[model samples]
Target: MITPIYRVQCDGPGKEWLSLPEGHVTGADVTADNLIAAPTAKRACNWPGEKEAKRAAVGAGWRHAPDSDFKTWFCPACQSAGTRP
Candidate 1:
C-alpha cells in the first residue's frame, strides 16, 4: 500500500533526521538507517501539534460538490508559487 512519508527531527540527547514512512519512526537516537515500519495507523499523531500539516491536509485542494462534503484537487501552480516569491 502507498503511504505518506514524514521527515522527523531527533533532538535533546542526540540529533538526527529520519525518513519515517507510514511504518517508521523518526526521532532521537534513530538515524535514517535505524528506521523500521510502524503500525498501520502510525500517522495518527502527525497532525496533532502541527498547523501547516492540518492546513495541507484540509485546505490544499478541495471542493464541495452536490453530494460530497468536499472534493480534493492538486494545484500544480501552487507548488511552484513559492519559487516566484
Candidate 2:
C-alpha cells in the first residue's frame, strides 16, 4: 500500500490537528483524454501523458503551468481552456 502524505498544524490554544492529505496517483490511476473520447470517436488515441501534456501546453501558448506539481495532472488543452485538472 502507498503511504499517505500529510502534515500537522496547531489551529489555536484549543487543540492541534493534521491537514487533509493530498493523495498521490500512480500511473494506473491516470487516464488519457483520448481514451475518454474513444467511445465517441470509435478509436483509440494512444496519447502520451506528461510529455504530451507538456507539449500540448506549450503549443497552447503557456510558458509554465502544466509543470506545476501543486495540482493534478490535467490535460494541457484543459488547463489552457481554464478547466479543472
Candidate 3:
C-alpha cells in the first residue's frame, strides 16, 4: 500500500508524480504502521478531503494526488497528462 502526498512514480508513469498493490494493502500492509504502507518521511494524504478522493481513485484502478493543481484525482490515462506546470 502506498499513498501520495506529492509527486511520485505511479504505474507505468508519465510523471504521475501515486499505490496500494491490491492484495498487499489488504494483506501484509494491513497493520503496517499507518493505514497505507507509505514512507514515514513522506507526508501521506491523510487529510479528510484528499482521503475521499484517493478512495475513489483506488476503486477506479488509478492513483490520487491531492496536491495536483487541477484539484481532481486522475485515472492512469489522465494521470500522465495532469502534470504540474
Can you give the lDDT of residue 44 in candidate 1?
26
Q: Is candidate 1 or candidate 3 better by TM-score?
A: 3
Clashing pairs for predicted structure model 3, backbone only: 7-17, 8-17
Model 1 segments beyond 4 Å from truth? 1-39, 49-51, 58-85
- In the range 1-85, model 2's lDDT, one tens digit per residue, is 7543332212123222221113423344333221221112222222345555444333333333345552233333344455532
Q: How many pairs of residues in model 2 come into backbone collision?
A: 0
Residue 82 of model 2 has an lDDT of 57
TM-score of every prediction relative to native: 0.20, 0.22, 0.23
| Cα distance off (Å), candidate 2, residue 53 | 0.0
Say which candidate scores most in TM-score.
3
Worst 10 residues of 3 by lDDT: 29-38
What TM-score does candidate 1 get on C-alpha atoms? 0.20
- Which residue window of length 10 is worst by lDDT in model 2? 33-42
Every candidate's lDDT: 0.31, 0.31, 0.41
